[model samples]
Target: MEQILETLLFASDEPLTLARLREILTPGTSEPRDDGQDSVAVEIKQALAAIRARYSREDSPVVILEVAEGYQFATNPRYAAWIKKLFKDRTSFRLSQAALETLAIISYRQPITRAEIEEIRGVEVIAALETLLEKNLVRVSGRKETVGRPILYATTPEFLRQFGLRSLQDLPVVDENASQGEEAAPFIPDQGAQNPMAPPATDHQNN
Candidate 1:
């Protein structure tokens, strides 16, 4: 079971949830294990734990990480320098400062309208929002319920994967010492620590 889990994690480009793992292991069935164990759920947990422990050594080059509400294998950041050299020609998307700030606001206060984001940034965010949308990092979740029913924006799963975050809960804590109405610094993932998935190259347009 551990070997199968390891192979699946290694071959997958995206994170795999426990539910997803179970489906892959035992498709079209929700029945409990016949061996009298707790359940497939418990068995998967044990397998994952063993896999994690096997790669937890100080010299391990790859590690299992929970990102985007799922588990994935990621290269160790310590070896990032060497790995980057091999993928130097791969396309990477770089976010502008304006877009970064807008994204930060949306991430912290999601299901928000464009007007609400503009209100906080004190400037128009159309271009920044467009850039984010083009990059598939931000998405239109739905519309607000109030008058006009303005569109609401939120971060995408790609955002979490790109930033190597397990979830929004992994976002950096907002500074409490800032003055009222001050815009907090945006959270930027370390270039060296980003997930190995490289987004397609697009024209670099400043926001």
Candidate 2:
């Protein structure tokens, strides 16, 4: 089971959740035992724990991480500088300061409108919204149920993946004492790491 889990984790390009791993491990049957405990789930967790332990050595170059509500292997951030050299020539998606600010607002107060973002930033956000949309980081979730029914924007799963977050709940706590004019700090992805949580190289032009 450990070997199978290791191979699956190594081969997968995205984080694998427990349910996903179970589905792969036991394709056609229910996992609940007569004792009412989920045997497969218990075994999977034990295997994952063992796998994590096996790779927890000080000299290990990689480690298992739980991101986007699943598990995957990523190179240790301590070695990020050396790993970045491998992808130095590849095209990477870069967000402008304006776009990042806009994204931060949307992430914290999502299902928000462009006008709301503008009001907070004290500036128009059309271009920033466009950049976020192009990157698939944010999306038009729906329209606000108000007079004009302005389009509402929300962060996408890609945003969670790119930012290495398990969920919006994983976002850093906001500083309540922060000035009203101050924007939330954007969650930046670790670049050039061979981790599913890291943003992948793209063909799009930098924003």
Candidate 3:
């Protein structure tokens, strides 16, 4: 079960939630019995533990992490500097701090108006919003039912794919301070490190 779970999580681009894991582990059940489901949950928990322990070994290049309420493997952060060197000159565009902050705001507060986003972020967000749209992370979902009928923005599937999220429900609970005054986000290859989808970055910033 540990090997199976490890393979599934490692192969998935998005996070796999507990329910989703259960579905994949046990297919075609109209209503799983409570006792059976409980046992299955325990098995998955144990497997996850073993998998985490195995990847924590010193020789491993990646480690599994719970992000967006699901598990995905990430390169160990301690090796980021060295890893950056390998793709430093490639065609990649790292989202700027402002872009990240705007993205975080939009991620948590989806179907939000640009006005509301600016209010929360306390700055003009046109450029950041444009950058996010260009990256295919944010999209105009609909028009708000307000005086101006402002265009609303929500995260796209690409956002989930890039961030390893199963769904909006999987977003990490945000404290007020963290939401408003968040700092620069560390770079994670929006696309795989080996294949950058954007043009080459001269200043290592996407925005």
Candidate 4:
């Protein structure tokens, strides 16, 4: 069953849920009793915990972590410095000021349309948006219901993982110097938008 879970993790492109693991382990099984479902969920949790422990051993090169309500295997953070140095020149991409601002807009006001973003930034972000999309930091969450169906953008989990955020709320608040005493940037959705997405916008910013 551990092998099964490992295989599922390797094959899954997205986070595999406990219910998903249960389904895979007990194919064609139907709802029997409440007790049965609870028992299975407990088993899966225990199995996942064991797997986590097993991979967290001192010599393990990789470790599994839960993020964005899902589990993924990643290299241990302790080794990140060396890993970065090894690939530093090859992956030495830096965010431009425009790109940074565009990403900030999306991180705060997603699932926001391009028009809405431009309205707030007071400048067209077409090129910066493209760059962010290519970097896998921003993604199209969906299209707005408005006329012309503008595509809404949101930050990806890769954004969170790269930024060392556990979730959107972990994003720091941008204030004072960053926005020049302007309205603290929008960190959540407008009424009727139903988009609960927002990320930290650090208050003490160097950039």
Best by lDDT: 1
User: Higher lDDT: candidate 2 or 3?
Assistant: 2
Worst 10 residues of 4 by lDDT: 190-199
Cα deviation at 54, candidate 2, in Å, is 1.3
State how far residue 46 of model 1 sits from its true place (Å).
2.5
Off by over 4 Å in 3: 30-37, 91-93, 119-123, 156-207
Q: 2 or 4: which has the higher TM-score?
A: 2
TM-score of each: 0.75, 0.74, 0.64, 0.62
lDDT of 1 by residue, 1-207 (tens): 999998999999999987788888889767544354648878888888766665653335677877787888887666666666789898667889999999999998998999999999999999999999999999999999999999999999999988878789888878767889988566555533343342232222332
- Each model's number of backbone clashes? 0, 0, 0, 3
lDDT of each: 0.80, 0.80, 0.73, 0.69
Ranking by TM-score: 1, 2, 3, 4
Clashes of 2: 0
Off by over 4 Å in 2: 28-37, 91-93, 175-207
Look at candidate 1 and tell me the lDDT of residue 118.
Answer: 96
Tens-digit per-residue lDDT, 11-114, candidate 4:
77666656567777887666423364577767777787677666654335555655554566666554556677678778666999999999988987889998
What is the TM-score (0 to 1) of candidate 2?
0.74
Candidate 4 segments whose C-alpha is farther than 4 A from its true place: 10-14, 30-37, 57-59, 85-89, 147-149, 156-207
Better of 2 and 4 by lDDT: 2
Q: Which ten residues in a row have the lowest lDDT in candidate 1?
A: 198-207
* lDDT (10s digit) by residue, model 2, range 1-207: 999998999999888987789889999777535343888988988888777665553335667777777888887665656667778987677999999999999998999999999999999999999999999999999999999999999999778877888789888778868989988665444422334433343422332
Count steric clashes of candidate 4: 3
